[model samples]
Target: MVHPIKVQLNDLMVKREEFEADVSLRSERLDAAGVGLHGSLLDKEGYPRADIDIMSIRTDRKRIAELTNDHKSVTNQIEKLIQELHAATKDSKPSHDRPSAPAASTTDKPPEQSNGIAAPVPAGRPVHAAQYSRPLAVVDGVSEASPASRAGIQVGDALVSLGGASWESGTISLQQIAAAVQASEGKEVPAIVLRQGETVSLKLTPERWAGQGLLGCHLRPIGDTTRG
Candidate 1:
């Protein structure tokens, strides 16, 4: 029999994923249209960019922000569930073949903590993304003075999960990540990346900077590589 809290956690995760997907789709539309939240929509001479659809961009940005807030709320609930489950497990009699529940990682060393979860990776494969069991996107470039660099995300880092967007039985879903970022602007989103054979957990706060996109980094789906 499964614990009720675990079932609740699963439901919360599903809710988070729905928020993630919605954010990704809206964010992708904004990207395709070459617009961003809080960025100048005006062109030279102070006129709105003639090539863009101003209203649609605004709508997408607004929805993304709303979803981001909702996602965070759900995540907080999930964290509380993890803690509750962890405490309960700690007091129970030990079993030789016991089940583990997800718990918050320690601030000093997130990777070493949280054994109640799944896989970890760095480059080729995520050495579970914390907030994933698989990566939907991989960090291909982390420019200087950008959010990605600030967050400790490096080149060739394969994200097992970010902003609650993930894949099933497969790896790399750029769409999920695109929505994840869109919905997570100005918010510290929990993520896990595979870095050099180690699972490095971090929080990526997508925000506006002096670079492109909220992250200022390029994420490519697995099998998609940049040509030199």
Candidate 2:
């Protein structure tokens, strides 16, 4: 029979997965809004640019706020679950094996001091599956004046989904995104990305822009240390 703690951990894992998905979506939205606002709605100093769309920026900001709250709520829930799991495991430890203090005796000479001292035990770090899992592709760089740059595909943004497949769907990948672009033949392809804790949708048209590749961006799988 599965242990009760194991079941609880599994439940927490499922909840965490859901939270991750939500966080990625919110990040994308935030990135898209920021891209839209860059130069168009705000100047370098953050003052309103000439011909700025105040209404559009306001709407984007409101959405970002709502998404931020949602992301925070889910994150707090995940942390609480992790803490509870730690406590549960700690409580499950057998108390009988715990060391007892030695009785004081008149002959005891305050325990002989040792010349060599043991190293201090390091604190245990919280372990979460999310820490090791790569659920999306990361944009490492975007060429200037390229199709991707013009479409607001910024570096550090996580490509969570493309062409209707998402990381949550277990099939999203950089190669899949490239294939979607090639299949589009210069048409607009819908993409969902995670940027700064929000989900944002973008219409990416892979065309021969003033760059090397159609997208003109360097993409690496999340958790991949090597460049491609």
70 Cα displacement, candidate 2 (Å): 40
In the order shown, the candidates' Cα RMSDs to the true structure are 15.9, 20.2
Could you give candidate 1's per-residue lDDT for residues 43-104 as a string of tens digits? 97899888989988888888898999998788667656655765665456466444343465
For candidate 1, the lDDT comes to 0.64
Any runs in candidate 2 off by more than 4 Å, and if so which? Answer: 1-135, 168-172, 224-228
Q: Can you give the TM-score per candidate against the true fold?
A: 0.42, 0.38
Per-residue accuracy of model 2 over 130-212 as CA lDDT, tens digit each: 22123357665567798888888865566755544444334445666576678775777666665543446677778886656
**TM-score between model 2 and native:** 0.38
lDDT of each: 0.64, 0.54
128: Cα error in model 1, Å: 23
